[model samples]
Target: MTEVLTKRKTLLEARDLHVQFASRGRKARAVDGVNLAVGEGEIVALVGESGCGKTTLARTLLGLERPTSGQVLYGGAGLDYGSRALKAYRREVQLVLQDPTGSLNPRHTVYEAVAEGPRIHGLANEEEIVRDALSRAGLRPPERFFLRYPHELSGGQRQRVVIAGALALAPRLLVADEPVASLDASVRGEILALLLRLREELGLSALVVTHDLGLAWNIADRVAVMYLGRIVESGPVEQVLTAPRHPYTQALLSVLPESPEPVVLTGEPPDPTRVPGGCRFHPRCQVLGVGRAAEVGVDGKCKGEPLAVLPAVPEPQVACHYAAATGS
Candidate 1:
């Protein structure tokens, strides 16, 4: 199926973003030349293993971290972090951290926690805003939870409270980082449902950052696979998840518990400071040697030209030379 990329109006965009940091005298490229977009009312999953730069990209998108070399566009305009516009933009977008325990204040009551945003911004009707936010986040009868503290709530409740805090500001877009990783498996469904419910009820968009492909399958409208600081594959969730084009993406999905044939690799992904030349994934591609290198289209060029994301019609965009040749 040819998946059209622009099925909705874009809400946020990252263009050739590069966010690097100095580590041990070498540059650690956490996010390298990544171009991504989240459309209005769309739930997009940004998936990758740890240290693949997904978190960094999320932070950059939220303006929590500055990109070293690219522009982060919010609603189609580049954000100038110094201006008043950036602050206003932030109020429109909010972040849900991975760990509820770490994000929620140990001392603050649910009311205080949810009320902080509006109070800080000097918005009107703090009490009403807090109740509405909590209710929207699925803490039914928000008054019942207003006096409770983080410890007084269940794992799921605490997550909902964290979510409520974000929703309090009436954000149009949410950047949820590992939103369910800290919750119990049973409660994970509840939180995921809440996210979907918020989108449906409030006309909100979301960028859900997680390594779980199943979660993406469950809720996201689209999926983007990140590897070594760049997007290797992205398209409609059903298309990219079922028919991954990049070799790295194919290897990732092959190991899914449901996959009939699972393919494994020999080594770990290379270090960020010492990434492989040409294609970052070339060193670990299993089929590179299985088929004659020439026949498989793996050659010196594959090991030399750093792969950039290729624009493909109908999405399912890829960055691997062998993707077209091997049908991966």
Candidate 2:
């Protein structure tokens, strides 16, 4: 097993990040003015509904996709994207993609697939490095599994191989984007346990991106809730999950399918392109309560003023005009 490192600075940071894509002759902001950080050995979860840009933000962090503006800082310096920095960044921050089979090449055996990274980077000899990576990823007794192809392994094993490939680079931060989504529910728990144990053993920080609040509840130290390219709320795991301040956050938690129904924040979320003025959530917010905007400082039916990301009661930050009104 790889010995976990001790005493390291912030592993990754993304500040004022924006990601835009041209769609229908118009620029669509996938990630809009986001800021986040991951400590040396802490796990932060990016939670949101689908199409909220969580995946895009993760991709931006990994340099798989470039942000339109803002900066992603790693180890105190801006990610350069120059040859040296790119190479270093790729090694230090790796992504465990959602799809195991899709991410792995069918033609390559497990040994070839896992060894590819070290070979491309000229970091180590193939045979020794492949064995080490497979072992590290818990394909224990590595020699027995090295020659198998993606098709030969079960979904869980294939995913482990994918993780092995990423670990071959000895990354300090692992960006897991729904890494267990495709697995069966029982297997999902096992994978989560494996990931958590890996963090403890390797001292790795993780940015786990997922739309499932349940999954976030299982593994996250902190949760940042995003809605339509903006962070609606964020804080420690228990606080944010149990006492959500933003209506959107509340809505997300209410529909979790767990027993003991939470207070449901009514109304559908507003469309991204045509977001309402001031508080974006006011359109569907039950707390808006007919001409109560002025009380919360939202003027004229949520048109009163620009929205503010306010610090709510209990250590959480919620971006909602009525966070104080909600007794959050």
Leading candidate by lDDT: 1
Model 1: per-residue lDDT, tens digit, 274-302? 78888887787775646544686566657
Worst 10 residues of 1 by lDDT: 307-316
Clashing residue pairs, backbone N/CA/C < 3 A, model 1: none
User: How would you encode candidate 2's per-residue C-alpha lDDT over 1-328 as one tens digit per residue?
Assistant: 0122223356788888888888777667788778777778877889988888899899889988888998899988888888887887888899999899899999999988998889888985678878887887879899999899999999999989999999888889999999898998877887798889889999889999998888899998778998877787887788788877777777778777783676555566545555556766676675675555566665453554556533211246777766655565
Question: Which is the leading candidate under TM-score?
Answer: 1
Model 2 spans > 4 angstroms off = 1-8, 262-271, 289-304, 309-315
Give lDDT per model, in order.
0.85, 0.80
RMSD of each: 1.9, 4.1
In terms of TM-score, how similar is model 2 to the real structure? 0.89
lDDT at 48, model 2: 88
Structural similarity to truth (TM-score) of each candidate: 0.94, 0.89
